[model samples]
Target: MKFLQIAAIAAALSALTFGCQKKAEKKASYPPTPATLVKAEGKSVRKYIDTLGTISSLHSVNIVPQVSGQIVKINFEQGQFVKEGDVLAEIDPRPYAAAVMQAEGNLRQAEAQLKIDALDVERNRKLAKDNYVDKQTFDSLLAKVEVDKGVVETCKAALETARINLDWCKIKSPISGKVGLYNINSGNVVAAGTSVITTIEQLDRLYVDFVVPSQRLYDVKRFMEANGGKAAVDVSYIEDDLGHRKTVAEVDIILNKIRYESGTAVLRGRLDNKDGLFWPNQPVKVRVNLEEIKGAVLIPNMCIQIGPKEPFVYIAAPYKDGVYVISQRDVGEGQLFDGGMRAVSGVKDGEMVVKSVSSLRLQAGPFVYAATPEGLIMGADSKPILDPAKMREFMSNATAIADELRAKFAKEAAEAAAKKQAPVEALKAAEKAAAGE
Candidate 1:
């Protein structure tokens, strides 16, 4: 009976060992986690200083008349584009024309009188030589001739002034620009240099005025010195219906003095406004490119993860059978650009970065399959499974897979706890047995 019992005990122990080995093999067969990755690119990244800006015309003029008169006719439509010397409005020219005529008549009279006085002086000079005329009378005639010549010059000046005033009656544009509404319309008299006739803003080129902290002035100067004495700028604005628009502008001027109250220096950039997309006094965003970092590692903004100490990114290395091993890397972040890209260091060019992971507790050395941002698992060819039927099948079983993984993790945790308690439990049992003895 003892031999039979020993054989049965040996068989039971062997079966239990086999069952434990099989369970271990099954647990190891779980599929790799899915991860989405983006390839880091090598490119030039520009460092910029961002600030708010205002769009202003390079030339804005408040049109005021040089001569006062009644406005007879408005020659330009409201908001019309006018060239320099284009007739904008016509004042009543009747009075001005009459003044010119009167001045001409007076000038003609002065010339006639001067001619008579000169003839008299010539005839008297001959008489004085022959003693046919008195010496005092001849001298007086010559004096009259000189006085008449002075009167002619004065009348000529008056005529020129009258002509100029007449020309001013027709108000004309002094610059090529768009005209604003007429302030003083037809039949209304406007004071010279006092009443604003209209406004004109030159829209061919615009100025983007912005301010930067005074501390950044040195940086701007450095960039300018390196880049042909001018730094590049980007001006952007958003419209109500249309989306954002941006254009490259040239930095033209920096104010000589900084604002004491704001501790900022004013800067201006020139933008081409031929498209008429920008307007005076319009607010916009300005980005001043202070410097450029060549051959910088560029990655998507989403790839960066904030850690307790610093920012980090997950790098993926190709392992076996289309699986990747993930590793964390601390990185120094640089400038952020449009289109959700950022400049970073400590990442090699052309390396794959894990953008996201399926499991929350994913750590280093975990095998992961490449997946699309849409969660579709990639095939052995490293392409996403785009077939609708296959995608549906994978999605349908995703919940089951997740549940299985959760159960497996829970079971492993419980086994580890049990292992830790096993030694303590045995020690307690031995102590209890000793006490009983």
Candidate 2:
């Protein structure tokens, strides 16, 4: 009886092992996943350092009055584009004008008195030479003429100063730019050199200011030193109604010192804003081109997948009948460039990579079919689908296949769960029966 029981247990174990093997075999067989594939190309990829930056006018200034007086007239409309030397506002010139008139009258009076003194000195010298006048009297007359000459010079200087003050009443724009709103309106008194009248920013040319890690300072310096003291850069920003726009610029200068708190150095690029696309103090995206990688494998950024250990891409090798064998390859450091592409290592030129696999449960060593974004099966060579009827038919079939696979996978999962619970249910039933006995 004991030998028979031992043999029965051994036979049961063997059968269980066989059943597990069968399950494993069934799980290993998977349907071909549909995905879009793109061929990797070899090209020179420009490496860039991306960061947020701010737009600033090349020349910005705050307009102020040169003489203190009440504002009489505002010449410019708010937010109007103005040119250099354009009168922006006018101060009460009546006071300054009156002072100019007073200075002119004073200068005229001084000149007339100096002429009279010169005549008196000439007459007194003649009298002193002829001995008709006493020496004391002639000398006294000469001293009086000299005193009058000194007074005339003092009046001349005062008149010039008064004339200058009169010209300062008119406030003009110092640079060609758009004018900001008025700070002090007409009829308000503003102090000279202290009160701000308005602000202007030159929009024909702009400066893009951005910061990068201090470690990258050397790279930027190298690029500039090699390329005539200017490094290539691109500035991009979005408009509310116009979507996105980008413009090329060049780095003009790097700040002399780095910020200790952020460990970054500031770089300023010169950007042409003749179209007025960029504004002062506007935030923008900046890309500083450092260097180019030659003969690098380039692929669309969407093809990269973040795995548990590292970023990877699925390489697809042509198999039989429009199917491909998928193999996951771990890529090295990647640099993003324009047009949604990235330069990456570990992929070779002319190799096909899966562009998108988010909807598919994929693994290494599985077969996949190349499909378009619209789910139309592509040709074995991944050529463009030119036939409308064929695309429609394939799209319908692809949708049906996807739905069927999903249902089948769900059913299998349900069955596996049920199988796992069957033994527990059986054991519970047996325990209840034994207790009842």
Candidate 3:
């Protein structure tokens, strides 16, 4: 009896000792690595698709001499702007003038022969009626009259040709345009249709051609139709300024046909070159902004993490007085901001998101480190664009979270081990059953 009583007392003491032993002290809390903090900042975002293209003249033609001769005079100054009908070069017109006079003389001779034939035909007709001459002779005279008229017409055509050739000796501007340097200087003999004097390109109203991906055809067409007119599209043309793009002009026009192989299409806009701000054959960049989108929520680009296939972003929830939990979600993004993505869905326009990217650790909140403010990227006085080591520090803090989890559960782990159950299985079964219960 005394032995049983002593054993009972010992058991009570053992239970008391075990219960009184201090549980594993809670691990110290570290500031959470941010998943980049983002505020609900609303701003105007223009949706643009950009591509490179070359400038072309709306109307351009080459100046070539139509008549060949020794260039007696360079009528226009080299590289001068000339109006339509402006005489540019003077060729030696002596030979062509002589040809014109010869043609005129030949035409007069043909007309003289025609008059004689007509008189003979008329006299023979009168005499034949009175049997004053042979019937065959009168018939022959009538035939000669018809033949002479044809000859006269042929000579007239020759005269017209000679006159035209004479006029062509003075090379004239076909269109009002700026003429390029002379191909044939004065004193150089040139052949008709074989010499290129220069080029004349009309610069007043120019075709500003820009190419876009063929894949955009449907989107462009659909948007154009939805907008109810071609004018609904605004094309902003830009060029590099100090290594950055600045739009110099904006206009509206129709988009040309789609290219099948490359799946791209061209757009043209009218621009005035009176100020000589643009040049032909120069490269250009274009952005077609289809008016304002009715409702689109833009999220920060740092929030959108790009994976191999699909893109994703993390959302943080603050629950139960500082416990923050993070959940990952896929999002559709459009035109990128300087540092943010224009989120189409999976996030509301005014919702907060991770932007600075240091708080990815401690998904279950309470460890949020208030975000440090960031300003726009400044120039030469700018800070380094990137800091990897700083990011790594956050990543290390996030990783260190695993140790606290290990320490907090030391007693539970020992009890679970004594019960002879696998820790992984217990975790899964416990989580699954706990969720169900």
Candidate 4:
């Protein structure tokens, strides 16, 4: 009777296991689908190509010491914002003052000599005219007067030069701008030749030197030509942290040719920075609108999915039962329009493309159950409704996978380097052997 009980128990356990397996298989065969189907409307989307740029000043100037002397005093503080006629630094004027005094004394002596020469010339001419003196004597006196006049002129020139040098010791500003760090301190000996004491970058007008990849330049020129070639290049400055972008006055220029070294053409834009915002060499983002992809189909940036090979979208098409079914197609993307991807090909106006393709890539299996906009559940909802949070997680996973692959490559590279080093070691040993070690 105990053996019979055991056999019955074993049979019951086997039946229960079989039932659980069947249920699991059924559940695996059909997964839960989304409730609402977001159909892809056929339309154009803009592809915004993002790049890094730097901000610059329109009138940046450097402060160099032209005349040599000890930097007696710092006329302005470091990082001080100054204007066109502001004084920046001062040089010791004592030496220049002495030179001016010397020049002035020389000029006075020259003037005295000129007066004596003039009196002699006049007296000699009168004597010759009265027939009491010879023409040779009068001519010699006239020559003396001419030489004295030349001496006076030379002394005057020297005096003017001395005064100019004396004035230069004041070390006023060449331009209105913000001063850079002080390279030379007070009592530092500055010379005539070379050494930048400081720099003054004029922030009122600024130029941005940026590179265009040459792909979008055509669009830019065309857009500008439609409005007016030179007039159309609009300059805008955006402050950090989502600050409002403002348009500065009349400061835009495009470089004619691409730089052969970088394969990118340099473009420049000018900004009127009255608020002293942009400084020289400060980097910022600059967007230059070239031209419009006129009448091109536009769609929400979220609608399209960016893959390794190309961008694609999911659209709704009419199937057998007057219901919209999801269809996937590749799109030809153009320049970015309004921070969105521009759809150049593969779509038409008024067609719906599904937005947020990340979730759809995972949620929909080989076939998704789709619920139509008409509120009819045909089969299961095959069209994907985006759960932004879940989609973000999937995207993060993809990025993590990419990072892992990169790490693997890096590891392999390190291992390969170790292997290569071993051969070099052997080569060194062989060389030591040849050297009779």
How many residue pairs clash (N, CA or C atoms closer than 3 angstroms) in each of the candidate models, in the order given? 0, 0, 18, 42
lDDT minimum window of 10 residues, candidate 3: 376-385
Off by over 4 Å in 4: 1-50, 222-227, 231-251, 300-314, 318-322, 326-331, 338-340, 354-437
Give candidates' CA RMSD values in order: 10.5, 12.0, 11.4, 19.6
Write the residue-wise lDDT of candidate 4 on 320-371 in tens digits: 2223334566788654455454554677776655553235433222122344
Instruction: Summarize candidate 2's per-residue lDDT along 1-437 as a digit string, tens digits.
Output: 22223323433444455567855553222355778899999988777898889999899899989899999999999999999888899888888888888888887888898899889889778778999999998888888788878888888888888888887787888889999988999999999899998889899999999999999899889988989999988898844354367788889799999999999999998988888788889998888988778899989998998889879888888755566656678997577776788888999999999997544355321446788887667875567567999766655654444334434444554566579999999999999999995
lDDT (Cα, tens digit) per residue for candidate 3, span 210-296: 766777766666766776544222223353452242233433454556778877777666666675555678776655665465566
Evaluated against the true structure, the overall lDDT of model 2 is 0.79
1-437 in candidate 1: lDDT tens per residue?
Answer: 22223323433344445567855554322455678888999998778898889999999999888888888888888999999999888878888899999999999999999999999887778789999998998889989999999999999999999999999988888899999997888889888899898999999999999999999899998888888889888788845344367787899688999999999999998999888888999988888987778998889999998988989987887755456656678999987887888999999999999888854435211446679878778876668888999766655554344334334444554566579899999999999999995
RMSD of candidate 1 to the truth, in angstroms, is: 10.5
Error of 4 at 75 (Å): 2.7
* lDDT by candidate, in order shown: 0.80, 0.79, 0.63, 0.62
Q: In candidate 1, where is summed lDDT lowest over 10 consecutive residues?
A: 1-10
